[model samples]
Target: MSDATRLVAISPLHSPKSPHLPYNRFLFSSFRFVSNFSNCLKIKHTWSLKPLNQQGSIPISSVDSSSPVSIDLKPILNEPQFDRLIHQAQQLHESLVVLWMANWCRKCIYLKPKLEKLAANYHPRVKFYCIDVNNVPYQLVVRAGVTKMPTIQLWKDGNKQAEVVGGHKAYLVANEVREMIDHEDQP
Candidate 1:
């Protein structure tokens, strides 16, 4: 078994804890401290769980990857606010691409930049967005049949167009999206 699995077996989160290791004690203390701080600050500080790519937040799409083209996967716009985005895209007759990602997923981490670059370069024509899978409801994921992180789904005129799963080369996704846009323009 893997070292991680063995350690997990020894200290299962679902089971009763042992006082032998300092890990649990540290965790409990940290949790308690955070909880107390959160409660105290709850009234004074208003916390919004927006995505990482907000105005002042770190840009998720500027991350370095092993690929040639660097992408920026930051939420160039705002929160999920899908309906508003859909309305805008429909009004402009532009195709929209939504990226579903998780903060902890390594593949998603790697693909973020590429996605962002696509959004930047393709802006005003092919609209792009990044949605944290953690923030979005499970029903949305299940309804969209999103079985993997770093998934990209395309939409046009409020209708589902296509979807790409897993991390893909930036150029390939851009090409596919451009084709979709072109195909859409044909009479």
Candidate 2:
């Protein structure tokens, strides 16, 4: 026989009753190893992926949780509260950040907490309030010129100073908000 034929004859894959047959122990063991390795990779990938909202996933801003710098943002429940807060901020010469949002808006939900956290840095200087456009009257929303779901407006002396239309990603919106706060002294 030729060298090629001799090699094929000695190979278990080419044999009718070889130990490496398709349904034999050796083939089964190889398949089991591959399957187990694939499952292990899947498990390892799952463990490595961390969720954004999970505890310890986000770093705390400061070591002291009870510091005066911590800001507690509350939603404006009604038109009366909205009017009152605006008037109060104007009287106190403090800046007011009014977030025009809708409950059904996914972007609004994600951006709200981030804005609240951002408000902490300007605590006592700026106050943040969330207003669900769905819950509030149509006239109030119209007055604010909120044509979008997550429109963030900086109000001072009962007038709109700077507005951020959150039609983009959360991070970009947050950056724009920070820029607005940073340049708040500009006309």
TM-score: which candidate is best? 2
Encode model 1's per-residue lDDT on 1-187: one tens digit a residue. 2211111111212222334422111111111112234334222222121123323233434443232222334453333567677878889888888888888988777676556655655655677778887877776677667888777888888877777776566557656655655576554
The weakest ten consecutive residues by lDDT in model 1 span: 23-32
**lDDT by residue (tens digit), candidate 2, 1-187:** 2211111111112243444332111111111112244334211111111112213232323232432322445788888888999899889998998889998999998897678667866776888888999888998999889999799999998888999999999878978998998888897
Deviation from truth (RMSD, Å), model 1:
16.0
Runs with alpha carbons beyond 4 Å of true place in candidate 1 = 1-80, 167-187
- How many clashing residue pairs, candidate 1? 8
TM-score of each: 0.51, 0.64
For each candidate, the alpha-carbon lDDT, in order, equals: 0.57, 0.68
Error of 1 at 18 (Å): 46
* Candidate 1 structure lDDT: 0.57
